[model samples]
Target chain A: MNDPIEILLVEDNSSDAKLTIRALKEKNLCNNLVHLTDGVQALDFLFGRGTYADRQIENKPKIILLDLNMPKVGGLEVLKEIRSDHKTQFIPVVVMTSSREERDIIESYKLGVNSYIVKPVGFDNFFKAVSELGLYWLLLNQPPKL
Target chain B: METLSIEHSISPNFTKKDIEILKMYFELSKKYNPVISEALTADLADHPLWGPLMKQQTPEQRKAQNERSLAMQHAAIYEGKWEEYSKDLLAQGVMYAQMNISYSDWYELIKMYKDYLLPYIKKDFADSAEKAILYLEGLSKFIDFAMYGIAEAYFAEKNRLIQANEERFRAIFYNSMDHMTLIDRNARIILVNRIPSHYNKADVIGKSILGFQTAENVETVKKAVHSVFEQKESSVFDTAHLAGENKLYYSSSISPIYSENGEVNAAVIISRDLSLQKEAEEEVKELNRSLEIKVEERTKELRDVVKELESFSYSISHDLRSPLRAINGFTHILKDSYADGNEEALDAMDEIINNTQRMGHLIDDLLEFSRLGRAELKKVTVDMRVLVETVIQELTRVPSERKIDITLQQMEKVTGDQNLLKQVLVNIIDNALKYTSKKEHTLIEIGSYADGGNIICYVKDNGAGFDMAYYGKLFGVFQRLHSASEYEGTGVGLALVQKIITKHSGKVWAEGRVGMGATFYFSLPKPRK
Candidate 1:
């Protein structure tokens, strides 16, 4: 197992998360993809608190895939906290969600999201979108040295 | 008669010395006659009532009248004959009546006679002051008797004149064109003149006025009559009557009549009918009320229809699309996992996915079309040139390989909702670009001009033009002249354009020739100067 998470995916839907992980694996990009079902656990992992208190803070993921609609501690609130704190400000956060509403897109960009992607209905399109995004953020895109 | 005259003398106890003084007084009067005569004649000539006639007399006749008045005053002072003075004033009163002089003018003339004699009497009796006092006392008494006689004659003449004038006024009052009624305090009609053909004097007179008027009028009349009696003042009110099918209106005035003690005893009510005027007014009021009710009903109906449309739109957005997206997603998954090895199964899955996707797009477009109707217009001055350029730039973003020639002419500024007009331009220009994709060198033109008192805007395209015979279906939702294979469209674009144009109080139309080209035109009213 990897020592630190390379990617953290915060999504409430199980099928959507499985499909996303499958796409990244097909591209051989998921060496260490940490999937959390809701925003609370995702925040716990990122800030090294709650269930993830034993983990080190410096082992933050290279990128976060956040879904806007969730049961507790929604994606926007998590993004706002990540941006305000100096420890996680530079982490490349991308919004990946099923909502294609203009208001949601605008709010994600306003919160300094690195990229926004609308989940396509067809599996083929979804697979292509997730894989391309994974390849771009993990491989081609540069992150600050940790 | 001569003894009676002597017995009626002003002073029978006159001494010989007093008689000599009187003879000298007459001589002194003659001496100052020229000086006193002009002032006396000028005063009478300028009198308000008798001036015109007196001014017409010759100077000699005026002097003679003045001399005659002075002689009469001299005889009254010398003999104390007040009766002769009274007789002279009576003769003057007769002359005053014949000349149509006013009572005020007669009084003023008598005062002038005394003024002319005062200085002459003073100068004549300067030697014997005691004789002067006696003569002046006798002169004042004689003038007082003359005044009493003048008053008696003047009033008799005044009464005769007033009687003649009263006869004329009576004729006018009784035969006036308008109906006049006099009612007592009990709301009883006491006198009614110029009665209509259907009403006799006996029918209206001594009857309760409340019977002739409507209930509302009766209340108004009662209030007006009560106020008149309480305040001892006059008040007017309008009342209406129904004579079979005809409606008669009248304006009645209530005035108080006071008895000998100066206390109000009764009221006089005068009514003037205004049925024609009142009928016209009532008709107009009824018309206005009915029109207002009609407008209110129409507005309610329109609101109900709008509410229904809004709910329908809400269901389409929330309920229909979620299931469609699920079907499309699951079908695509099936095609990828199990059906990939079977070409027929894969094809069937692809068909389901495509149909659902089309349905989703159609729903979105329909929702937008409905929203446009309900959207509040935020009007601003829109530059059509910038709007067109922006829409074209957006449409050409993907970079089509087909050579496209786009021309933008001089466009006018229009006042409309910026977002809505932007949508209108986008839909139209987008159609132009989509249809012309098959052409080798497609030409699209955008321009505007002033026509028919409005700013006319148009988009022309060298694209797939349809038969004019199918023009009726041009802007109908889901309507299509061509099949999906020939040209792809949900058929809501033109209908949306029509709706948006209609909302702006503008008009939209199209002209086309099959296989040649088509142009869509819309007009907006120019901003008021």
Candidate 2:
């Protein structure tokens, strides 16, 4: 309970996942980084089900970095679920994806996403984008009290 | 008067003794009248006036009636009163006509009587030769006078029959429903049946049939009429006549009328109106033509939509995904090859990352461009000045090192989708900012002017302008004249701007010169009531 998750990264691609983790680590903002490969697992963790049943539901992540193009239970659907439930609705969710699709951006915001960031192609810009998002969401962004 | 005197002088000369002889001849004629009458019928059976009636009469009765009439004529002729005798002869002529007897039959009866009486008279006056000769001459003259009367009555009966036939034929010609006309050999209209409502009968009668037709049709009708007369053959043709505002189509049939000597003297033309039939045929043809055009237009629209869908799929599968793979592949290689980072390797990795970012922007722009096709326009009366100010604020938020001065002018309120029009302003303003970054003092102007019923809003910038020659490619997807090194763009900004404007039922255009400046303009419809 004392070691509540700081960041929950839901991404399908392994390489993108690694790059994002490295960017956060370089910025010294990688404390208790929870990485889920698919949206289904990410939902399981958020609701404390399946493998994360033992974890308390009240101990929520500070920020959820969700990816849009995923194999199971895409990011938009996950965001919708998070907003509908009273327990998880207040949690800060940042939609991070390779898709700069306006549909995803507009829809994510409509579903109560705190931030929306497109992952840059170059490693440098990619690192900068993730680092800045990590610092802002973890430190500067004020989340509503659960 | 002269004919009367000659007729009087020619009367039979008879003395007092001759009269007695004539009376004796009359008594004897009565006995032989039947023989005379039988001989007359037999001799003149082929006469037109009596030919039909003679077949109906018995020879015995005919001879008896003829003998009495002959006896009367002899008695009347010798009475020495010419007027009274002439009257009796006329009465006899009328009786012959009433009985349908022919003139030739009556004349034959008198000749038979003369033949029978001549020997009796000659025997009685044998010693007096002059007296016998004079009586015979006088008898011959009386027979001639009787023939004149009978001939007049025969002609009067024949004329009555001819007049009846003429009336019946005239009724049929004048009462016909069709436009019947009689034309002379010179093609002049001699008579018309019922004239059409459009013309006077008198006007049409003396005119040629060709006069009422168009110039082209006149030649055709002329040829038809000519053939009917020259070859004495019937001719038929179609003709269109314009009477007032109405056009009448007719099928004309012309046939020649021959004279007694077998020469073509005139022609009869009968025309029937075909306007209703022609109108229906033309209407059907027009309907078929329109149906064909509609089918062709629908097919063309379907083909265009299919082509657009194919290109959209290609952009999604190939154009967007290719760069993503490169970024992913290169990043993996960089981490593996250089666990400890080197300057050159890091730079190479940075270049890969930059290209990946450009590709991401390109995908975003392409998605927007495609979405415009599907988006339903939600129209509102948008204030152009407010929209321009908001877009300019968004563009300048990137924190550029150079100073930019943006001027806003009074803009007309226009009708458009609020969000879509905002996107158009954002793209154009951002372009103005980016191109003017090299200038010492960047200046951007936003304004609108009236052009017909539309508001032509324009954004002008003092920037690195494009060549006028390549202006055509300015609004095309990924078509940029400037190299990637010279300007940082995915070359989709202007294309996206054009799409948004076009979706709002607006038009976009630009004017620029190399190293000078560019002015981008878009026209939107004025707000409606």
Candidate 3:
């Protein structure tokens, strides 16, 4: 857990979160991954607030996989907070959610999201999408140094 | 013999010598006045001018006229009141003229009196011939003076009548409501009824009308004026003037004024102000523009609401699929991890997986059905025959040993969205194939014909037909007459076909009888020639 977090997954549904994590683990990209259930916990972990206060704030994740629909603070608001701050603006934020609504896609891109993906209904397609996105963000895409 | 001058003058002057002779004649005429008056009054009854008039009078009227005649003669000769006698004669002349008496008739009556008096003058002075001539000349001069007085009265009365008529025309010319101007062929203002508020009467009287007109209207006004003069006809035109900040409109009508001998002279132009009407028309235009803007705004609002509803349905389906995916994924893992060698657990897991898959298919169909409503239609002329054949070829591409027969009748071309029309044909013919699969020999016929302004196409199949009692629910969303176990269907095929057809301004209907057969009909608008 102390090794620098490489992937940050933000999802409101627990089952969806577990499935996404499992897919990443199958690809062996889940070694340094952190899963937050909602947008509030994701924001707290990123800014080192609340239960994450004692953690090192300078330790940044390689990519943040965000979901759009969440309770008590949504993913778009979290993305807005992340992109607006100079300290975390360089983090690559990938929006992966079940919503194929055009508004959500446009808003996420307008907030400077690195990539957007619509989670497929079939488990095979969903597993493949998550695994490829994790492998690309963690292995292929070069993130700016914080 | 001294002859008197008989000049037709309104006012005649007499010499002193004529007065002396008239004095001598007056003394001689005094003795014979009674005889002359009586004889003249009796002769007046048969006179051409006075005969009918005197005949209608009573004897008392004749007696009064005789007495009046004697009194007038006595006033002239014996009393020497010639001034009074001349005044009375002149007054009577004016009265007669006012009563419409012909001047010839009045002159003839005067001559009758002179003829009667001449004989008496000659009889009184028969011994001295020179004296008789002198007295006769004086009497003639006296009668000429009296006639001169009557003639003067006639001319004065005529002049007064002409003056009255001139006054009447002047009143009308000066007191008109419209701005009436008299212009010559050169478009110069000769006379105007009302002067413009900005110009003096003196300044406008002789000025060229083009000077007063605005630049835009000068040519039009000049042309109208010249046309009226040349064509000898009236012309009307419109003109606009910018009066400071306000724009004034006027309509001028120019009519030719003919002079004597039928020559076109000056033209009179009457200009009426039309600014108020122009302003009213502008206001109506502004109102229409605002109304159009309001209608456009309302249409935009309605479009936004429709867009919102579409996105709402799209997101709901997507969200629903998310949970189903998780359930399927978790169940697959559970069956592999914990249900090994356990028949009951494996069967339950398989059931869960199958139902979840089914639900996923339903949601996908529902989303697609909703998307059809918002898709922009791309209309083109589509050949129905080619489209049906292609659909049939594709549906029957999979080789099977079962005997299958498909008959495609003649179909005319129609105008619609090509892809949507293809979708409609595929759905209907596929239903035919699916329902008729249970039969040993499958018979599916697709045909079309021109029905009024539309091309009606129908698919007939000898397959599992539904009861006619549920015909009302044929094209409704998710309304299926058959059980899913008997026929694997999402029940959205017919509804999708209905939506597409309705969007093309067409209709969809079906007829069926249980165990007999079923026919599905759809109509599309004919392409414009």
Candidate 4:
């Protein structure tokens, strides 16, 4: 719990989560990364509530890779909670999902999401997209001190 | 004088000298009455003014009328019945006037009667010149009295006719349903027929027209009245007035009434009430307003339905594709991890991957078809010849040893959404290319022609054609006439073509015979000039 969180991968589908983790691990950006299956666990980890009450809320992740469709709590509501709170508001949130819907993209931006990416169907394309996103956000992107 | 003196005479004011002169002339007139009457009748028949009237009478009727005239004259002087004679003369004058005889014509006829008597009186008094002159003067005075009576009666009859005409116009002026008033140049109401229900006749007759008008309409009425007088032309306007508890609308027409000297002395203002018409107009407006609201409500409901459909398709695009992605992703992983050197397992995993990829394509195509239903058409002139060439170029770009020939003929331009029209061409041409793949020489012909109000384009192929029996299912969604082994298709190409063409207010149909050939035709409205 004291390890500085590098990436927070919030996705419900296990195969998608495994593939995303593998893609990032190949790029060597998966260290200190934490994976949450649903938006409730994601929110709990971000705000130090419920199952993650012992975790420090100030020790926020460098980036949060969010999926729109999830169980218990949806991605947009989790984003709203993350953005509304001053402790987790500055953390970069990139919506990575299978939805190419205009409304989903618009809603992500409207809720102050840093970036939106539609997961590709082909394994090669999806691997490359995840690798590029991990390198850009975790390695290259400049973040404010949180 | 003693013979002329009479008791109970009608003219008791006649002097003894006047009686002597009248008695002498009456004696001479009685003796020569027959001769004088004949000459008078002949003179009237020849007189230019009376010739037409005298000729209308028979000779016997003229003779009897002349004798009756002499008898009446004889009774007036000899019988001293001047009152009766004057009354008869007045009645005759009225009768002549009614016959349209002019006053000058009557005066000329009287002169002829006196002229005929002068010669007779001269011949009878040949020795006494003084006595003859005196009788002639007295006869002149008697004729003058008769003239006065006839002229008075003629004028009285003319006055009666004028009064009758005035009465008729007065009846129309007062009995009319409209509010009629005559106003002078100063806008003072001089005369009004049928006073308004809101005012007394006395209040309206001599009051300024501005006083009766409401504050808002005073200027309008004043301007109309002023224009009629100043321009000497009629003017009209609409005005509203408050009468008791009700407001009334009126359309007033003010016309100049010209005097005899052609001057505009007054204006006749006729106002017709338009409150009922205005009320009907308001009711119609209210009805239209309610109808507009109903249309707006229906439109909002339809918009909500379209929004729901959009969200449904969005969910399908997202939720359906996620699982397919997982399946395709894990299958590749399994083929890489466990299927090493096992061709059967690797082949089975490839099959699974292929099917998952195919499912993704199906979801995309389905979402696209649904999107076409909601997309707004951006209409422009689409050149079909260039569009078909472009679609053919794209569909045939895949490298293959199979020889394909596409013959594109002259195409008429049509008005439609350009991108949608391109999709239509791509689908039909792609189908043509696919169906003709088995032929030794694949031949596809694309052509268009004008048909009445539409431009019909057709794609012809010479390859594996379908039986006409299944024509009804040709363009239906997922309804394929050929098996996957014969041809590879998701069966949504022609359905997409139909949807696009239908959106452009066009029609699509296909014709084919087994083992022969097939032709797909689509019609679009011609571009407006």
RMSD of each: 15.4, 21.9, 15.3, 10.6
Best by DockQ: 4
TM-score of candidate 4 on Cα atoms, chains taken together: 0.67
Candidates, DockQ: 0.13, 0.12, 0.37, 0.56
Tell how far residue B142 is off in model 2, in angstroms.
53
- Clash counts per candidate, in order, are 5, 6, 0, 0
- True interface contacts retained by model 1: 0.18
Scanning candidate 2 chain A in windows of ten residues, the lowest lDDT window is A96-105
**Candidate with maximal TM-score:** 4
> What is candidate 4's lDDT per residue for B1-529, written digit by digit as tens?
0011112223335666776777776667667767766667676676676777778988788668767777777776667767766776677666666676889877877677777787777777799889889988777766676777777776776666667779998998988888888999999999988776778878788899888778989988888887898899898888777788887889989999999899998999998889877889999999999999999999999999988887788789888888888988888888888897899998898889888887888888888888887789999988888888788778878899999888888899999999999999888888888888889999988899999999999999998999999999999998899997689888888899999999988999888899888999999999999
Candidate 1 whole-model C-alpha lDDT, 0 to 1: 0.78
> Candidate 1: where are CA atoms >4 Å away?
A44-58, A84-90, A121-125, A140-146, B1-119, B122-138, B142-341, B363-413, B416-422, B433-447, B460-483, B511-518, B527-529
Fnat by candidate, in order: 0.18, 0.18, 0.61, 0.76
lDDT of 1 by residue, B308-333 (tens): 88766765664565566567766766
Q: Where does candidate 3 stray beyond 4 Å?
A: A1-6, A36-95, A101-117, A128-146, B1-267, B340-346, B389-412, B440-443, B447-453, B527-529
Candidate 4: deviation at residue B153, Å? 12
Q: What's the C-alpha lDDT at position B127 in model 3? A: 91
Better of 2 and 3 by DockQ: 3
Residues B422-488, candidate 2: write the lDDT tens digits: 9888889888988887899999899999888899999999999999889889999999978888878
Clashing pairs in 2: A121-B356, A121-B357, A122-B353, A122-B354, A123-B353, B33-B67
Clashes of 4: 0
